[model samples]
Each structure stands twice: as structure tokens, then as C-alpha cells.
Target: MPIDHLNPPTGAMADNVIGFARALRKAGLPIGPGAAIDALAALQLIEIGKRADVYATLEAIFVKRHEHALIFHQAFDLFFRAEEDWKQMLDSVPLPDDARRKPPPASRRVQEAMAQPLKGEEREAPQEQEIKLSVSDREVLQKKDFAQMSAAEIAEVTRAIATMRLPQAELRTRRTRPDRQGVRLDLRRTLRASLRTGGDIVDIRRLGLIDKPAPIVALLDISGSMSEYTRLFLHFLHAITDARKRVSVFLFGTRLTNVTRALRARDPDEALASCTASVEDWAGGTRISASLHNFNKLWGRRVLGQGAIVLLISDGLEREADSQLAFEMDRLHRSCRKLIWLNPLLRFDGFEPKAQGIKMMLPHVDEFRPVHNLTSIDGLIKALSAPTSGHHGPLIRPAA
Candidate 1:
């Protein structure tokens, strides 16, 4: 395990350690200056030649969560792999061939972190060469698939999603509220107020139907094919939950698990971690029919009340596709104000509802929209704000 091939750190080891910590922070890890200082002090107790010792020491000080381990490992490898000066090594490192195959999210972030010059160090100027104009980073990010985004890009997208506000279109309820311009006259209130004037009414009191935001019920799929998109969708759900009071979140894979309380945590990371711990199946096989049946039988009446808008996030690749799935989908559609099916598979330009599950559930949904990127998510917000009639009416079939 000893890295005897590499020399021991020089007087500048402290700076190198601090720079590496900063890189990890930029890559969405929670490492800070204190952790960096602790790492440097810990390095003195163990022989730096032992790569295992160095890795453990840094990991213990830097990594705070299970998900962060990948980012830390990739960053450490790229940062400390050089036998020569670390700064020079970073400068000489070539970018991965993104055109051929996209790097994993963690690896891409590690590469971006390594490309940055450390504190007190200056990046060498590029040789004078012909330059070409390119699209803006934000534009490119908006179009990029959630699964293809790097850790840093994901963090940026999460921030953007958090700031996104849903439209304030309220639904009318049977309850009434006091309003001067109301159509219904309040005789009781008018009579009570006229007591001071000895039955002489001064003003006419009126009441109007109370309005509240339509409740949102998200039924998210967590099967193997949907693992990547589900994580991002959960972040979106967290933001929605924080913004509104009547939001319910449920995760389904082999079974249905209600995660509304878990996702209510203020911190996105903590909320997601809590959800992971509570759900037995994170990236398991799909049993869409069974899960939908469970939801319709048990939770349908409870969460799908008061003009709820159900957001079904899934690929519709059900392992147990049957007549029951269609039955449950129809039941769910009737119970909610709107049943919007958000499918990540729709990102494919030539996508068709050929899958058994997709075909069965397609007719029940009020609208079908892609949920693979930020732009698609924005489109969903617009669709919810201004729902159209016959957007995807019956008789629409998948291409054969």
C-alpha cells in the first residue's frame, strides 16, 4: 500500500493539502479550512509513503457523507498521482475525451477541480492561437441531461431548481371567506353590524369562495433505470415541498414508500439521506403495477384529495405490467385534478410509448412531458400553470 514510488512532501505540502481541500469543496464536498488543517496535522503522525495511510487520513478529515466518497476518491487520485510537483502535474494533465464517452459525474468534477490553479499560484497563459466562439456555459448546462452533469454542474442545477417558483394559480374551495367584491351577500354579518345603528344597515357584507394552492402529489420511481433521474427529481421535490404546504412525495420501486416527512428536512442532503435510509429499495427492480395498486388502495384517498396534481415521475418500464396497472392509473387519474406523467425516456427525440407499462398508463394521464433536464422541468411548470384541453387525448398510440 505504500507509495514509495513518489517522494515525500516538501515545505509546500501544507499549501498543496489546502489546495486539494478547496478542490473537493468546489466539487460539492463539505471540506473546509479546519478539515484541511486537521488533514495536514494528521499526515505528520503517519508515513506519507504509505498511500493507504494518506488516503485514510484525508478521508477521515474530509468526507462527511457516503455519497461524497466517490468525489473525494477521484479528486485525491488526480491531485496526488504526480511524482513531481503537484501544480506542474495538474497543468500538464490532459482533459478527458468527452466526445467519445462522458466521464462519470465525480470524475468530471475532479478534472475541473484539478484544472484550477492553487492559491498563490498563477496559471500559465495559453499560447496565442486561433479562437472560435462557443455557446455560453449556462446555455449548455440547460440542455445537458441531468445524468450527464458533473457534480459541480449538478450543484449549480440544484441551486437553480431551488429558486424556481411554481405558478400561484389557486383552486376554488367550498369554504367561504370575507370579501368586499364577493357575489354572495352575508346577511348575518350585515345584521350583526347594524345593531349599533338600531337596525340601520350602513354597508352590505359579502363572502366569496376560499381559494388554496392545488396540492402536489409526486409518485417517483426508483428502479434501476430511473436511479439517476430520481435523485435530481427528489431535489426538485424538496424545493417544491419547502415552497408549499400541501406537497406529498412517494417513492416506488418494488413497493411504495411514503417519503413526505423525510423530504421535509430543510437541508437537501439531509433530506435525501433520510429518504435513502427509510426506503428499503433504492435502485431495485420495478413493480409498477403492484406499487400503483398499493398507492391507489391505501394512499389514494388521503394524499390525492383537495384538487391534487399528481406528478408521476417514471420510465414506465414495469416488470409486472398487467391490466391492474391500467386500472390503478385510471383510478389515480380520476382522484386528482391533473395527472401529469413526467417521463425521462421522452428526452429521446424518437421516443414512443411502446412499452407495455407506458401503453397501459398513457391513456389515463392528462398530459405527458419530458423531465430529463432543467428546460423540461420549466416546461412542466408552464404546463401546470396553463393546462390545455385535449393535450394528449385518447386515440394517441405509440409508433409501431
Candidate 2:
């Protein structure tokens, strides 16, 4: 196949490399001008007899950003090397040829997804329609599991999460001290300010608005074990940001790092790529208590306003099962509206809060949910809507 017919390895458009880079960016490859020029130069250097060889060369630059690697590989395979196949089968609109088309491997957990609809048909919210979920199995029998998934699959899941929103976040008043923006005037503060007016001999007015910014703070774990799930959750937080403005996202591994601003990008892939660029502790160890203590000290005041719902996302596996874990949990619980703990380990059929870490964190959380697969995520959406439902701890494990 001649190069022109096969998109000419992106020819004269080489000067229009920025456009190509943008296309790659949309296609979920972490592309930039520098890389595009490199891609063009590499093509000139390498023998392009085989399409695969050329593709491998390009993949090197685009996939440098770890998360985008899978995406670049998938889009590269599908877009280039069109062959006569997709054209030949255009009438049929069939799948690509075998060399290009591979079936879902035998280990596909189709049964796991089958056990539940992930999200039931009842909640008919338009923006939240993409909230489809996959299950998290406690005993992951499959290796190279999340690692083996194509970028397209993960992208679909990521997009679904990006648009998801909570329909029922009804606000309730916990206590009122009276301030500027709220319904009542602060008797104390108003009186203090009025004292300036000579004990309010004239028109009396109040100052200072005391309304809180709705309540919810998320402290997520992006350690090696929780990496795949955490990546998805970041997308979920992005969706939540749209649904609820000013939502904070803190990622933890051996230590704590904040990526709230990065995930706020208007574009999902761009947002995820920016997030990937900001974090160095991508696949490292977990330190729950340490992370919470750091969060409780550093971020507790800024984002944890209005009795915020503290979401602790991590598997309760402390490298050192110290008592500070409980102390931090106690502090975290006391400081928020509700402390909700999400553990992917809870996806196990026979899961029990067995680990010292899990046991320590369990009692701290007002609610505990799994975060392993898509179904678990969908359930999380449901849980968000009607948190009072009696179906709280119903463990529906995925069968092989």
C-alpha cells in the first residue's frame, strides 16, 4: 500500500503537525508539537516497509505519557493501515480483518458485568447516562487484567464517568449562627459591628456572609494496587466537579499529592493527561493513615468546608499498622458531614473487613462501598442518590 493512500504517514500536513497533534490529543494520545516533529523525523529515519514498524516508532513518542500509551496503540492500529478491508466491508459495516481485529480474550469477565445492570433503568438523567460500571473482584484471579484492557475501553469508561452527575444532593441546615448571606443576622457579630454605630442608635445592619460551600472532600488512593481503579475514580471526580463545583481531588500513595486543578480541564483526555503529568507517585505503596493525617492537617480547612463529606478511597493496607491510623480516622470522621470509605477489596464475594488497616478504617467510615469494577461505580451513583436506602451492605459478588 502506497503511503498517500494510507494517510501518507501524515505528509505535507507535516507542516500542519499541530493539527495532527490536536487529532492525536483528541484520540487520547498525549501529543504535542515537539513530539509531532519527532514523529515526522523518526518516520524519515526508520524503514517504513511494514506498517507495524512505522507505528511502533510513532507510538514511542505519543505513549511517553503512561496513561496515553494504551490509547495511542489502539487509535494507531485502527486509524492507519486501513487496508481494503474497512472499505471492502463498508457495505457490511463489519469489523476489521483478523490481523487488525481481535476478539475479547477468553478471560473476559462477561459474567461479572452480567450479574447486574450496574445502573438500573430507573434513574433517567441525561448527563448521567454514561455511568455504566464494571465490577471489582476482591480476589482478582486474572493477571494483566486492567493492564490488558485497550485504551478505547478505558476511554469509554472515562467519558462515561466524566459526564456523570449526582441528581440528589439535597442540602440540609446543620446549625445556624447568623451571618451576612444567610437567613438570620448574627446577634453577636451584628451587635459587635453595631457597637461601632453607638449601640445602633440609627439603622442597624449585619455584615459578613457565613454560608458554606456545600459539603464534600475526596481523598483518593492512587497506589500501585489501586492504580487502575484510582485512574477511573479521577474521571469520576471530574464528572463530580461539573456536577458540584469546586470539588477537590487528593491522590495518595507513599505520600499525598493534590491534582484537583489538573482534573478540572474542560476536556476529559486533556484533563487526564494533565493529571498524569502532575503526579510522580503513580504506582507506589499505600499509606492511608499518613495520607489522612496530611490531609487532615493541610487540606482539612480549605476544602473541608460546611461539614464536608470526606471520601477516603483506598484499600486498608497500611505498610505499618500503627495506631495513628485510628487517630487520623477519628479526626477525619469528626471533621466532616459523613466519612465514606471506598475500598476496591469490598468487591470480593467473601470479603470481610479482615486487614488491621481495613478494620481500623471501617469503623471510621459512615458508609463503605467497593470501587473495583464498573458495576461498583454505578452502584456508587445509586448510593449517592438515595443514601438512606436499606440496601446498603448487600454484597453481590461477581461470579467467574
Candidate 3:
């Protein structure tokens, strides 16, 4: 039987759908009123009491991305449960161990959204309470690890990263452009000027070497352990990519995938979505050595020219031999003007170079830094802005 025949389009059911949509929107799904209306219409075409039918109906209308399916189901399970179940849960009634069924864990954003009062609902105002923040919320967020952040906090941080501007790490190129006080004399222009003056008087035109922002090539690890930090770092890279045209981004897990073009989109969310769709090995096993070898073999000379700076963002965990990793790291370091290693593992208080991969790759990087938080990113901008002239020696600054 159709849902309309059994569960008709009641006002209560409509309200429930709208409220559920609100909860999902809060949980980071891009749900709007139109989606809720569509979901309700879809529900009318299916049997409502059958959980699978209802879920499919709503999911077809609401869930657009593969990654959001988990959030949708978690919210669905919590919102569509029996009223008695909610009462039991809210009232702190404990079920007997024999009767209890443990559900899979939900993301923090979903839990927080479910706890909040639904929009446009009238409720009594709570009693006032005093709250003090010695350090501002933004300040605290700057130092918080990306792995430890809640979904809402990640959203906030992503926005902050999108607004960040990369300092122009200028490089003096051989290519010249017209400048008033340029040192190089333009003989052709000087000759043209002499002809205009009937060969009696000559004027000299000077050209200055173009000062362009150094190209940035980022190789980010997407292994399971580095996924959280990498996802956030990609937001930062997106910001830089949009600001500058020369930035190239690559994601590596079991292999290397160039996402330079993907991140060139003006919208950060759209760019990241494109990147996620293009990458097949996200949050998969690590093969640091193989990925680096692939990068060095194919993309080394192409993107590494014009004094490019290479940012290797990884935990330096390799499942293969360290010998190959060391060779590739050396090749990459030699190709780029500056090679900075941004390791999230450096955030640990007692981090040591015990891992063979870490030890082998350490000697090749000009700078070793933490990239687990916003403050570390700020430090990176400072480091990049500093002068890079006559600096050929290996400089390894330990994490603070």
C-alpha cells in the first residue's frame, strides 16, 4: 500500500520532516527547506512504516554525497525513533545489559544538533549564567589540533583558512619587463627612440627582471592517520591556490594524484568536493616511498622550476623500505628552492625520529615543522616570507 493510503500527509508528519532537515543542516549537510519539501513528497510515494522504504525516499531527496550518508543515517535513527525511546533516553533510564543493543558511534556534529531545540519552536528562556573565556575562542581554536576538532569547529577553521592570504615569496626571474629605474638597458627601444629623434640624440630604456611569487608545489598524504589534518590543510592550500595562479597541489596515499587543477575553483567547498571526487585512495594505506618516487619521476622538473617551494605534508610513515624514501626525498629537495616538511605527528609532546621513514626523510628537508593547527600554519607563513637568498645548507629546526 502507498504511504498516502496508510500514513497520509499529516501536518505532524510534515513538521517532523522539516525538523529532521534542520537537524541534518546543523550536522553539516547542505539541506534546505526545498529538500525537506521534496523528501516529504517522496515519502508519500513509498510505504512509510517500512524503515527501508522511508530511508530510501528521504535519502534520495537529501543525501547527495557519499561521505554524508553516515551523518544522514545517524540523524535518521535518532530522530525517527519511538517517542518512548526518546523519553527513556532523555530521562536517563538505563536498559538491562541483556536487552541493550549498542548502536554505532555518530559524529559529534550530529549529536550536538540532535541535542539542540528545533528552530521556530517556542520555549521558556533559560536562567542566566556567567561564563568567562580567559583566552578567546578563536585563540583556543588556533592551537587546537585538527584531529581533535568537532565538525562545527572544523567548519569555522575552514572558513578562517579560506580567508588567509599567502605572503608573496618573490623570486627574481630572468624575464624582464619595462621599469623606469631598471638596470638592464633595452637596446631595441633605445634604437627606436634614436630614429624618432632623427639619430641626433639617443634615449636609453631599461627593463627590470620580473619579481614573481615563487611557485608552490604541495604533496599531501591522504593515508588513514594523516587524513584529518590533510583535509584541513587542503582548505589552506585552496585559499593559496585561489590567491595565486602558480600553486600546485597533489594528494598521495598509495599513489600520487595531482589536484592542482581541482583546487583552482573559486569556492573552497566546491574545490574540495572536486578534489575528493577525483581522489580514489583517500584515508587508505600509506606508501610514502612509492608516492614520492612517482612524483619525482613524473612531476619533478615540470612544476619544480622557477625556484618553486615544495611543501611535503605527511606523517612520514612508510610501509616500504626507507632506502627508496631517502633517495626520492633527496631528489625532491634538490629540485625545489625550499623544501618544508609539515608533519602533524610533530604536535606530540614526546615525538622522536624513531620511525625509519621519518629518520630517512629528515635530512632532506630544509625546515621541519608542525602542521596540526592554525598557529603552526601562521608560523609557516612567517617562515616562507623570510629571505631565501644564499641559503643552500640544510636547516632542520625542531618543532616547538
Candidate 4:
């Protein structure tokens, strides 16, 4: 493709594409000035009047990831249109009852983006008004359930989550390093120091066990029951992965899928897009036993070493009562130094181990905590940071 079309005429079509690009950027696609220019050039190669050709041209130029496709489509429909079509849309025409149908409303982000003033235009400021506030907006959001949050709120939470960092909780290894005040004596190092002193004096060298941050292995459930929570948790995991190189991530629904490399991308949006593309069983039925079995047999030995911490994020609602679920859970617990079960269902005050999977797996987890809101996630961070003895002992639930 000869991109010589860059010198296209600055016609009304050019203006429309520029305005459309602005709307897309506001709606969260990474549209820059160069992208807008490229879009214009690509449009010059296609039939301007044909909507399909125009859409394809602009989409190819602007849409970098799969998740942005919906936002792009919505913005394109609302931004690009003929005056007559807009007039017809504004002034509704009467139609037979059966023929009349309501169109799906645009997403809040797209609506707000399109409502913004175009280039060289001024936006009217809101009138000042006195209002009394109790709690701040963020305070309320911290406790709000992920499933109940609005798109705008979710965006804010995602940004907040990006800033959150995991504490560098280190574990001592068998390997030792020379230390000035270490308890254990290093005879070899001490003898070497004596030789350097020509046996006149001996400088005793002490050794201490090497300490490094524990690796994190997250197995997230992407089943229908966990779709909302897992999506938000993935953003949190992305932050963890960015800060720590030893983090490994896996997504499980009907099967186990390793997404560690995909999440290693620096950009959170791009990382999530790659994850969505790699998984074919998103929002499907949960097969906890089978998924856990596969994970233990394949990835357990690889990622569970070096005193790694395992995060099991799921509702624990298995589709089938597989007898292997308990065995797999135990195997996983044994492989990892700490196994933390993060269940969104724990947000409920009356939550109990009623589900077969929950009951079977609960006993193996070192900690069972809620993962439904930001506060809960903060609690998880604290729990991981605080030092505790190995194997807190199996949990015995009250009989139903």
C-alpha cells in the first residue's frame, strides 16, 4: 500500500475524520495526532461516500486492540453521518407498532466523548452551586462492588488499581551471602581474609541466607459466575505483574490457559486485549476440578517453586461435583508456600461454604478473603505483607 495518499486534500471529509478521532480518544482508544493523520490518508484511498469503506479505513488506522472495537463502532456511528440522516434521527418519523424498535443506547463514555466541544469550540462551564458532602467519591468507590460499578466508576477504579503496588515480601533461601554481622560463620571467607593479612590477623566473615521477593502465581477463573470480578482482578494483576517480574498469571474457565507472557506487556490495555484474544472459553461454565488438575499436572512444578504465593480467584461454584477437586486443591496447596483463595462471594455477610467446591477447597487455602471491592483488595495486600508461619492448619467449617 502506497501511503503517498498522505497529501490528500483538506476537505470536509478530512474535518469529519479529525473530529471522529477526537471522539475516539475521549472514549479511551489511544488515538494520537499521527493516527488521525494516517486515518485521513487511508480514507483518501477509499470511496468517501461509502460508509463501509470509510469505517474499515478508519478502523484499521485507529483500532489497535479488540476491546476498543466496540467503542470505535459506537463513536463512528454517532460521529459520522449525513445531515438528512441526523435530521431524521432527531425528528422521529411515525411507523407501525411492529416496525418501530428502540436502538441500543450508546455507552456513557462514548456519549460523553461525542458531547465534548470540537476543535476551536468552547465548552460552557457549569454554574457554581453550594453542596454539602459527607464522604468523598473515592471513599464510596473503594467499598462499592465491582459488579455494581458504572463504566465511569470502573475506569476510575482501574486507574487507581494501576497505581496500587504490591509489597516486596521476601523469603529467605538456603543460599547464603557474606554479611558483616551474620550469625553463621563463613570459614572459607574468614581463611581467605587471614591469607590477605599474611596470618598476622584474621578477619571473621559471616554469612546470611539470601532473601528475595516471593513469586506470585495467580489462577483466575473467567467463568460466567466470575466474569465481572475476574475482569477487574486482571487489571490488579497487571499492576502486580508490571511491578514484579516473577509474577505468573493463568485464566481458567472450562480449561486452564496460561497468560503470564501476555500480561507481561507494559500497557495494561494492550495486555488485557492480548489475554482476551488468547482465551476462547471466557465467560463459560466452570470446571474447577479439571482446570486445577491440568494446572497442577502442567504449571504447578514450574511456577510453584521458590516459595511462590498462589492466588486462586474464583467463586468456587463448580459446574460438576468432580471428586478430584479436593485432591487437586490439596496438591496445589502443597506445591505453593501460601495459597490464598479470593472469592467475590465472600462479600456477602452470610457467606458460608455451601457449594461443594468451596467446601472442598476452603480447607486447603491459607486465607479465604473477599475480592469484590477495592477495600478487599487492599486487605489482600496487607495479608500478603504481614509475616506468618507456614500452614496455618486446615480450616474446619461448621456443619450445615
What are the Cα lDDT values of the candidates? Answer: 0.77, 0.61, 0.78, 0.76
Candidate 2 wrong stretches, greater than 4 Å = 1-150, 174-213, 387-400
lDDT of 2 by residue, 1-400 (tens): 4322333345333533344355456554456666776766666665645455555666675666654544454444444423333223223322234324432221112122122221226324422433332335222312223434566466455555665777634344455544445655456665777677888734344444333334557788888888888777877877777767757888888888888888877556557777777878888888888888898899888877665666778888888777899999988877766667778776566887678887776666677777765666767677555433231233233221
Winner by lDDT: 3
The best candidate in terms of TM-score? 4
C-alpha lDDT of candidate 4 relative to the true structure: 0.76
- Model 4, poorest ten-residue lDDT window? 125-134
Question: Cα lDDT for residue 399, model 3?
Answer: 77
Worst 10 residues of 3 by lDDT: 123-132
Better of 3 and 4 by TM-score: 4
- Tell me each candidate's RMSD, in Å, in order: 9.8, 13.2, 9.2, 8.2
Score candidate 3 by lDDT: 0.78
Model 1 compared with the native: what TM-score? 0.67
- Model 1 residue 195 CA deviation (Å) reads 3.1
lDDT of 3 by residue, 236-261 (tens): 88888766899999999998999998
Against the true structure, candidate 4 reaches a TM-score of 0.70
lDDT per residue as tens, model 1, 1-400:
2333334344677778887888888777887767776777777777666665677778888988876766676787777764255444234333333212432444654686677777463533211110111234677778789999877678668778877777554677778889998999999999999998899999889999876678899999998889888898888888877768889999999989999999997656667878888899999998888988999999999988778889999999987788999999999988888888888888887887788989899989877888888998888777666632232334322221
